[model samples]
Target: MIEVKEIEKKYGRKKILKGVSFTANKGEITCLIGLNGVGKTTILNAIMALTPINKGQILIDGEPLKEKTFEKITFIPDAITMLPQMKIAEAMEFMKDFYTCWNQDRATELLGFFRLNKDDRISSLSKGNTAKVNLLLGLALDVDYVLMDEPFSGIDMFSREEIANVFTSHLIENRGVIITTHEIGDIEHLIDKVVLIDNGLVTKEFNAEEARENEGKSVIDVMREVYIG
Candidate 1:
């Protein structure tokens, strides 16, 4: 489980995140949703320690996240820079050496699912395929927490569906996934909880089952009301 308590961050005079608090429990997928620039990515960065917060604590399983927590967390951002000169197979081999949790069989299966050729140069793959590889790497890492920022940003509909399904089925049930995405439809069925941020604050949090039972609305409908209404 991951608990973010009263996180606050600022860039000059503009406050990006203010007193944010949320929990992502194991065996559940919690989605962060909101309009662009509403601090969704900032929250993920803060949790990953990629961006230092001015205030508050980020805890993993009741313990505050420190430098040693890197092994427990895997982050996949919207834009990732790989050695564009390397081949797909070479990149996988490099990551396997770097992370103790790297799963070779899972990586191979993901490559096949995405129709990615191992010998293809990283720079030669299309934009969507590039994102697929990024996603593949994160999913294959055996970690407790996976934070994905805009994982569905540029993919086609069919690939997006396939990716979502694979993520759901392959994810370790004992771990947690916190994903930030504008494409709510892609994860509507997969997510267990929704945490919507707006104006730099957590404006909404709902469980899929509770929301459906109490509000009689789908996740897409709730999202429209939260960010668009």
Candidate 2:
């Protein structure tokens, strides 16, 4: 479980996150939704330790996130710009050596499942294929928390659907997954929990099943009201 307590962030005099608090439980997929410039990415960055929080704390599995806890978590950004000249196989091997939880079989399975040729160069693949590679690497890591920032940014609808399916199958059971994306339509069914952020603050958190039953609404509908209503 990851617990974020009263987190705050500011760039110079402008505050980006305002005392946000939430607990992302194990066995749940937590999706963060918000309008552009609402500091959704900032929250992920703070959790990943790429940006320091001005206040509050983030604890992973009851312990604060530190350099030593890196093996327990994995963060995949929207786009990864690895060496363009490297082969797909080469990149996988490099990641295998770096991350302790790297599973070679899992990587190869995803490669085959995605129909990506290992001999192909990263520079030659299409944008959506590149995103598949990024997703595969993160999944193979087998971390407790997989933080994805707009993993479906540039993919087409078909590819996005495929990627979403991969997410459903690869999620480590009893582990937490946090994804930040504007295209909530592709992932409504997969997400177990929703955290709505606006103007750097968490405005709402709802369980998917509960919302559907009690509110008779979809995640996107609730999001429209949360961000606009």
Report the poorest 10 consecutive residues by lDDT, candidate 1.
165-174
Q: Residues 1-229, candidate 1, lDDT per residue (tens digit)?
A: 8999999999998899999999999778899988889999999988888889999999998887776686788888887547888888888998899888888988898888889999988899887888888887787788888899988887787777767776667554667899998668656878899998889999889998788999899987887787678
lDDT of 2 by residue, 1-229 (tens): 8899999998999999999988788779998888778888888888888999899999898888777688889888887646888888898988887878888888888888778898888889898898888887788787788888887787887778788887667445667889897768768888899998888889999998899999898888888787678
**Residue 229 displacement (Å), model 2:** 3.6
**How far off is residue 167 in model 1, in Å?**
3.1
> Which portions of model 1 miss their true places by more than 4 Å?
224-229
Error of 2 at 201 (Å): 0.3
Clashing pairs in 2: none
